[model samples]
Target chain A: MAENILTPEEIIKRGELVFKKTKLMTDNELSYCPGCGHGVAHRITMEVIEELGLEEKTIGVAPVGCSVLAYEFMNVDMQEAAHGRAPAVATGIKRVYPDKTVFTYQGDGDLAAIGTAETLHACNRGENITIIFINNGIYGMTGGQMAPTTLPGMKSSTSPYGRDINMMGHPLKITELIAMLPGTVYVTRQAVHKPGLVRKAKKAIKKAFELQQENKGTTFVEIVSNCNSGWKMTPVDANNWLDKHMLDYYPLGDLKG
Target chain B: MEDVKLMKGNEAVAEAAIRAGVDAYFGYPITPQSEVIEYLMAEEPHKRTGMVVLQAESELAAINMVYGAAACGKKVMTSSSSPGISLKQEGISYIAGSELPCLIVDVVRGGPGLGTIQPSQADYFQMVKGGGHGDYRLIVLAPSTVQEMADFVELGFELAFKYRNPALILSDGVIGQMMEKVVLPPQKERLGDEEIDKRYGSWATTGKKNGRERNIITSLELKPERQEAHNLHLQAKYKEISEKEVRLEKINCENPDYLFVAYGSSARICQKAIQLAEEKGIKAGLLRPITLWPFPSKEINKLAEQVKGILVVEMSAGQMVEDVKLAVNGKVKVEHFGRFGGMVHSPDEVLEALETKIIGG
Candidate 1:
C-alpha cells in the first residue's frame, strides 16, 4: 500500500501552510475553559489588528469577565478595566491618543448589564473607539448565572427553573439598542462557531477597527458566542443550541453601518 | 513674573492644570468643583496647549477615564465633590493598586450621604485614610488659599509622577468657590509622545514600539504571594511619602502655650482665632497642614512637647483631630471644634472653643 503523502520539508518548500497562528497573539496559554468561544473571539480580534498593521498603535481595553485576562493573551498595549468599564476607559484612551487605534473587548454581563450606562453614553458621545461585545447568554466566568442577554425559558444557575419573562424581565437586545444611537457609525452582530462564520466575524472586526482608524465615531461589533460549560452541553451541541435558540433573537449580519 | 489673576480656587486649579501641560482632563459637573471643568471647556485647552478636556457622563466614568489616560503615561486629572468622589473610590483604588500616576481634586462638601454642598472638611479621613478598599494611600494635599489651589495643581502632578501614585488636592467648597489673587504658573508646553515614551516607556502602556514588551496596566494579581508583595511595595511607598512629603505652615509655634491644627479654609479661620486668642492674653499658634496624608505628624509631635494643649478646628464634627491626638500621643491635652451641615465657624467661635476646651480645661 502506497501512501501519497508529502513530507513536512516538501510542504514547506511548496509554500503551503494550511493554517498558522497570527504573531499578534502572545505565547501565553489562554485561561478560557474548554469549548469556550472567548479564545476564538480573542484570536480573531488580534488577527484583525495584525492584518491592519496596527500592532504598534493598537490599544485594547479588557473587561472583567472570562476575557478579563485578555491583556495577557493579546500582544498589544492593553489596559484592564473594572467590570463593565471598558468602554469608558477606551473612550479615555481614544480621546487622549486620537491617533491610536483603541478598542474594548467585553462580555454580555459586562456590556449589557453592569456597563449599560458606559456603553450607551460612549456610543452617544460619538467617541472614536471600537467595542467588541461577546454575548453567550449566561455568565460563564462566575458560574453559569443568568445574564442580561439570557433568553426567556433558558435555564441558568440564577434562573434554574428556566428564565421567566415576568420575573426576570426580557432579554436585552443591546446591539439593536446601540445601533439606534446616532453616535454609532457601525453596528453588527456576528458569530465564530464555524469556519465560514469565523471568517465573517473577522471581517466585521476588521471593519470596526478600520472605522476607528478613520476617526468615524463608535463602531460596535457583537459576537453571538456559545458557552458550552455554562450551557451544560458539548461544544458541538452548544453551537447547535445557539443556532436553534440564540440566533433567532440575535440574528447575524450588519444592523447598521 | 507672570500676570496675577483674581480667580476662584476651582478656576485657578483649571488654569494651573492647563499651564502645567496636562495631557487631558476628564470630569463630571459637580457643585463647588464644576468651575474646574467649566473653565477648561470654555478655554478649549485642547486648542491652547493640546490638552484634552472632556465632560464625562458621571464621576465614575470620569475617574476611569483618568485611569485610562494615566495608564498611557499621560498627565491626567479629574475633579469632583464629596458624593462624586465617593463614586470614584473604586477607580482611585485601582489606580493606586496599579501604581499609575494621576491627580484628583475633591472639592469636599458635607457628607456621609449626599451631604450639603457647602464647604466642609469632613472628607479628611477619606482622603488620607484610603477611602477605597485595600491598602493604598493618595498623596493628599490641602490647599488653604486660592494660591495654593493653583500651586498644588503643579505640585500634585509633580508628586504623582515622582512617586507613581495618585495625588489629591483636598479643597473644600469654600476654597473651590472663593476668589483670590493668584499668580498663575507660566505655560509649559505639553510633552510629546516621544518624551512620554522616553520617560515612562518602561511601565506605561503608550504602545509596543522600539521592540518593547507590551505594557499591561492592571491591579489584578491572582497569586496570593504576588498580591502581598504588591501590598508591601505600596506600604513602602506610603512610608517614603510620609517621611519626605510632610508639609505644614507654623505660625507662633516657636514659643506658644496653645497650638491650633487646621487645614484648608479652617486653617485661615484658625489664623484669625490665633490673633483673637492673643488679644485675650492667650499665646496661641497655628499649624496648617499642606499635605494631609503625611499629616505633619512629626511637626505636631514636636510641638506637643512645647505647647500646653492642642485644638483641631475643622468644618466637620471632628476628623483630623484624631490624627492630632495620635501625633500628640497623650503628651498634651487635645480637643476638637467644628460646625457641620454647611456651617462656617467664626473666629470668635473658634477662640471660644479654644478657651473653653483646650486652655480652660
Candidate 2:
C-alpha cells in the first residue's frame, strides 16, 4: 500500500520531485523541436536514473540522429557513439565494466536501418544492457525521410508518394522481432503521445533498466515517439495523431509480455 | 615445468588473454574466431578467475563492450571473422578515436561479403589501412604460429596500453584452427578496483563527485579545422608509431636473390616454400611481419636492396602487395600469389608461384 503511495499523476509529480532531488542538469532549451516525444522520453529517463540512484555509474550512449548532442543536456557522464551503433557501444561498456549501468538512446532510422544488424545481434546475443529505441516513423535529423518504422503511405522527404508497401514492404515490427529472440528477456512497446501512455512508457524504461541491474540478460524498450518538426505538425497535434494514426499501426503494449 | 598444451591459434589467444590479465572478453560467434569465445565460455573464466566473458548481441555490441571496458583501463578483447570485423569497424574507429587501449583478434576469412567460413587473409587492407574511418591505424600483429597467437596477447596489450590504441592479432583459418605447441606465459591479475579507478577514473564514468569535472569520450569535432587538426594529430601519432613499431623476422637473407614475404596462414605456407626452395639450391629467405600497420616495411626495404625479386603471398587478391611495393620502392619487383574468400593457400601453391615468378625459368 505504501509502495503505491503515488498514483500515476502523483508519480509524474514524484518523477519531477526526483528530478529536483537529484539536481540533474535541467534546461529550458529543450533541444528537441516542439511536439517531439524526446522531451517526455528525456524526462522519464532522467527521473528513473535519479530514482534508481544510477547517476554515479550510469554511462548513456546517445546515437547520431536527433539526440546526437543529448549528452549536453544529461547530467551523467554520457558518451556519444557513431550512428546506429549505440547498442553495440553500450554492450562494450557493460561488458568492460560490469559494475557500471549502461544504456543506449537510439532513433528509428539509426536503429532499424543502418544499425539493423547490430540491433538484431545485440538482442539475439543477450547483451546485458538497456536500449531505448525512439521510433517516430521517419528520420528527423536529416529532415523527413522514410524509416523502417514509417507507416505505409507515409510521405516524407524521400518518400514523396508515401511509403508504398508494394515496394518498401512494411513498417518493421522491431519489438515483435525482438520478442522472438531468446536473448531478449524483457521486450516492451510503449508510446508517449498521451499522459496515460507516458506513464506506461516510463514503467517500461524503468523495467528495462532494472532488468540490466538485476543481470536478467538483455532488455529492449521501443518508444513510439513523435517528430513534430519532421512531421510538420504542432506538438499537441502530433501527440493527438500519435494517439490516433500511429497507435493504430504501432499498438502500444508489452509485445513480449 | 609449466602445464604445456598443444592448441589451435584461436584457443591460444584465449589462454594468452587469461595469462595477460585481460579483465574482460566480449565477442559474437563467427567462424575461425568463435573458438576463442567458445573456449572462454566453456572454460568459465568469468566464474573461475573473476574475468568477464560475454557473448554480445552482435559484433558491433561486442566491440563496444571492449570500448567500454577499455575506457575504464581494463584490458579487453574481442574476436571475430572478416564479416564480423567489418560490422565492428564503427566501434573500432570510435575506440581508436577515443584513444582507448584494447585488443581485437581478427580471424580473417575470404570475401568482400559473407565470404567463406574457411580461412582467408582478405582483410589486410582493412586492418592495416584503418578499416573504420578518419585518420587511425590499429597496431596489427600477424601471427604465423600457435605460440605467437598466445604470446602476442601480452605483446599486443603492452603496445595497446602503451600507445592507448587498439591492437589486432591477425590470423586465418589454418592457424586459428590448427593445433600446435605453445609455451604459456605467466599469469597476472587485472588491475584492482583502486588502480582501475585511479588510472581511468579521469575519463571513465566511475562515479560522480561534487567538484571533479565530468569526463566524456567521443570523436565528434564540430568545427572543420578542429576536426582536421585532430585527424592530423592522430596521423602524427600513427607516423611515430610506424617509425618505431615495425616488427619483422628476417631469415637467411645473406646474399639472397629472392625474398619471400607473407603473413598469417599465408606466411606459414611461404615459410615451408622458402625451406623447400633452399634445399633445391635457391637462395631465398622469408620476411614475416609481426606488426601489420606499422608494417615491417623498413626491414623489408632494407632486405629489398640486395634481393632481385620479392614474392608477396596473402589470402586476399593484393591488399598487402601495395604496402610491400611501397616498401620496396620499385628497386626489386614484387609479385603476389594466394586465394581469397576463406581458401587457405597451400605450400604447394606458394612454391609454384615462387618458382614460376621469383626463381624464373
Tens digit of per-residue lDDT, candidate 1, span B1-361: 6679999999999999999999999999988799999999999998999999998898889999999999999999999999999999999999999999999999999877987888898998888899999989999999999999999988999999999999999999999999999999899999999999999999888779867899999999889999999899999988998899889899888899999999999999999988888888999999999998888988899999998999999999998999999999999999999998788999999999998998788
Question: Model 2: clashing residue pairs?
Answer: A35-A235, A88-B61, A92-B64, A92-B65, A96-B69, A121-B57, A122-B57, B110-B341, B110-B342
The lowest-lDDT stretch of 10 consecutive residues in candidate 1 chain A is A1-10
Q: Which candidate is the best by DockQ?
A: 1
What do the candidate models score in CA lDDT, each in turn? 0.92, 0.83
Q: How far is B302's C-alpha from truth in model 1 (Å)?
A: 1.0
Candidate 2 residue-wise lDDT, B215-334, digit = tens: 677777778999898888888888889889888887777778898888777777777887887788877888888788888887898899988889999888888899999999998889
> Which predicted model would earn the best TM-score?
1
Off by over 4 Å in 2: A1-22, A26-30, A112-129, A172-222, A248-257, B112-118, B209-211, B271-274, B338-356, B359-361
lDDT score for residue B287 of model 1: 94
By DockQ thresholds, what CAPRI class is model 2? acceptable
